[model samples]
Target: MMDMQTQPVRSQSRPVVEHGFVTESMTDTCAIVANLEHCTNTAVALQSHYAQGFLSSRHKHGRGQISYCQSGMMLVMTDEGTIIVPPGHFIWIPPNMYHQAQAQDGMCMLSIYVENGLWPDLPGNSEVFHASDLFECLMQRMIEIEEKGAFSSSTFDAIVTLIRDEIGLASRLDMSMPMPRDRRLARICNAILREPTVLRGKDELARIGNVSHRTMTRLFQTELKMTYSEWCQQALILNALARLAAGDPVTTVAMDLGYVSPSAFSAMFRRRVGCSPKEFAKQY
Candidate 1:
């Protein structure tokens, strides 16, 4: 409502890697997010254009955030989990939750912000939602209208309402792998994640973490709430998602992740992602 040029906001972000791994690039948060904190509107949207390797530094919003990945993949980390925002997908971020994102090559993102009191009963936690065709069309319309910055309150409000309902109807993806904070488990996870190809047995991996195999198994169950084998499979699928999103060939990704053959890899990928590797690659 007031002059748009009068607001000043600062955001801090860092390069995010697969599975919520923090990369070398990070920027500190400003004294306060100078932008958009006092806007008169209840709903707002913004589009970000970035090259490869762009990392949104760690920050939290006073309002809930909906990040749509129009192209490329965005690794968004939150306390709940690290969500993979592949093309044609969106992630729901709860208000006041710290989050960060890093995009693959030529990433374009459109985000909608809903002030806390505007919508209630939205998901209290973060989750990746598969974008439906109708939802995408509506979002595109929202982008078009918001870009013009001129619309009746009721018209824009209807779009936001539709978006919220559509998102609720959508299903979540098997994208987040439970992370452990225990030092021993963290070490093991980091080592295996560093090179997904390393098919180390539990005994050997436990040795790397300086813990007994029995101890490691117990820790995985208690800390991550999954068996070691279950956790490893999920980790590989996440890594594969990143590679496939980056446009790697299915065969190459399969081999690099230690799959005996593309067929085997494809079977696992299909089970987890509900699509063949080739289909996932085409989006990016």
Candidate 2:
């Protein structure tokens, strides 16, 4: 993880009226974000801290957002799925996409919002990607410039270009679990999310969804583009990430996720995440 400390800068924008969207009631960070939407600048960067359990209610931005999780973990919930943003990772949200963000173990996030059409080739859907060291440095520079109110400076423009190019080159991580659109499959998937540790076979899950096993298999491939088992493993990995980020022991997370042993879980986690759970947890 990027081991850097940053002071949260309060938004200078005036208080916004509560419109059942983003309000002061839903974490101060969300209110600051609400104000940034109207800024005329091509891009705006803000640093905010959120307490554990802090949640930003469903909201949409007029501009695309790149939210870097500097500390703790964040889950960005969208209609399609949940994207896990662990420490040292960031999530890219396309313009006008409604989503909710929840913080785990408290969070310090640096968000950069860019105007629509500013980067015409940016991904249209949400994605989570690891933040490289160089990318982090550029982001830090951008934040510093934003703090100094130097949006029009040549240096600021150069930094913005570099940051955008860095983002374009960053590899997207498989830290997301896409949800199925069918109500029956969605119900089963939600149940699994609620209790990822519970063991169930394809037939059992299909029965729960009131669909035939073959139909359930077809739905998984058609909607999520993965097999049922693959989806389950992904759900387990995501849930394990959240628990592990919150300081849960590897053994405990593995057991909770129904892994027969910690080593088994660690091996699988390493295969998927490129690091052992212990190494990943050390960041937090």
Candidate 3:
């Protein structure tokens, strides 16, 4: 999981400090620590407006990336799987991993790129991390530093070290929505994904691809290693998480997602997320 701290922010073109020592409890007393003259080991950047419908061509970087979105969501697609990063979550991408990004709405993002040898014990694959309050604060502070092209400082190194340690032991969630590359299965999968709540069941869904229900079911199992029902469940849950992040009421979201009743949806949500939908939505 990701984590965050802080208070009223002090606005300024450049962060100025009294003694250059930072505090976690009060933002007025804190400054977005200036960066290092040379961040060769961990280059950082920020995208304040990941605009609606944002899309990136497939690409790879030589450095590992740690990305956090303080608002909205990010969809990442790679050979291994597809990852959904909603508000209050973070995403990590290993160096040289070919991937593309899609955003349905605007997002505020902070990305730190670590030189290969400086990655430490972080995972080698992309991870969608649940951002904690502490990490949220840190990301904001980090972003402030990255915005200016020339704000380097010694304390910046210390901050990077803390970020590395925090990620090493943070909680992990099985939040990926893996997809098959097969043309036929991909077509059906995309249809259901467009409107996750309107699925007509496996038997009828097979018609989208002009295939027999049995064949479609087998194809899902073989290519994605997940049954059709399992895939649907995964899609629905991902949609629910996004809606909750947008501040939708639990009851309304449940009903809109086609749950028979709020209680039934709550049970499934709790089983899958280990918390009530109400509790989950409060993260933002």
Candidate 4:
């Protein structure tokens, strides 16, 4: 029988910070912090205070990555929109495509970069998924191996296989932000995303997009099937979800997003997400 005392416990907190953003020709931040040539599909790295957003690299490797913010958060903003990664949550960024990440707060990040081709059927793009209890345990165990330099043994191989299998069968990644395909509308969408909680008026955003307020409203309706206000509300909801995942108190997030009171925020979240912020926090 597996000994409970020997089991790895999920870390309760982390200290990672946000990275800014990167372009297509750039390399991953992993290469800068760790020895990439020595990095392996089975090897993993644990880091704290990861505060910079790495640029997007279009490189597609057979290697897949599992990144966890045990305490802080990461925003995996891809061409496909963003995936908010908070403590107890991990993001799977498949090989290739343009992808980048930003941390919301200080972070304790453990990255398991893999090469088993195990997650082919998963989303063709980046996604955030809740890490299972076993998967979280496996991640911590891998960190142990790294700290102890145990990668030379077959024990490490066993761990790798286990992780790959978990990825294959782990729950489907349920959280994602699908990108709008239209170039004109996508520009406006991206602007909102950069500063979701900010009270930037539509007329201001319209000017940023080099279009009139009327034109912007029409594009959102005719092309995206949502009104300008509706799209903005969705952006705020998504932003709130990220903030909540980062362990921010409901009162704080509500106020930061310009809500006058916690009850108002609760009402908005309930209306959009079908649950209160407290309930949503409990689910993750």
> Please, what is the TM-score per model?
0.83, 0.83, 0.76, 0.65
Instruction: Name the regions of candidate 2 deviating beyond 4 angstroms.
Output: 1-34, 146-152, 255-263
Which 10 consecutive positions of candidate 2 have the poorest summed lDDT? 17-26
Whole-model lDDT values for every prediction: 0.72, 0.77, 0.68, 0.62
- For model 4, residues 194-260, the per-residue Cα lDDT tens digits are 7887788777888887888888888887776667777777777777876786568999999988889
In model 1, the clashing pairs are 8-34, 9-34, 9-35, 12-57, 13-56, 13-57, 14-56, 14-57
Ranking the candidates on lDDT from highest down gives 2, 1, 3, 4
Over the stretch 1-284, how does candidate 3's per-residue lDDT look in tens digits?
01001112223344222222222211111122222113443555443355555665567767677878777777788897778876666888888788876664566666666667687577777887766677777766665665453355565676777777677656666667888888889889888887888848776778887889889989999999998888888899888987887788989989998887999999998777657888777756
Tens-place lDDT per residue, model 2, 172-197, is: 78888898889999988987887788
Superposed model 3: Cα runs more than 4 Å off: 1-41, 146-153, 245-247, 270-275, 279-284
Model 4 local distance difference test score: 0.62
Quote the lDDT for 6 in model 4. 29
The number of clashing residue pairs in each candidate reads 8, 0, 14, 16
Tens digits of per-residue lDDT, candidate 1, 1-284, equal 01212222223654222211112212233322334355446766655665566655678878788878888777776765556677888888888888867665567777777788776777788878888888888777766664465556787778889988898888787677666888888899878767766789889999989999999999999998889888888778767887887667899989988889999999988777777899889886
Worst 10 residues of 1 by lDDT: 17-26
Relative to the true structure, candidate 2 reaches a TM of 0.83
Report how far residue 182 has shifted in candidate 2, in Å.
Answer: 1.5
Which residue segments of model 1 deviate by more than 4 Å?
1-32
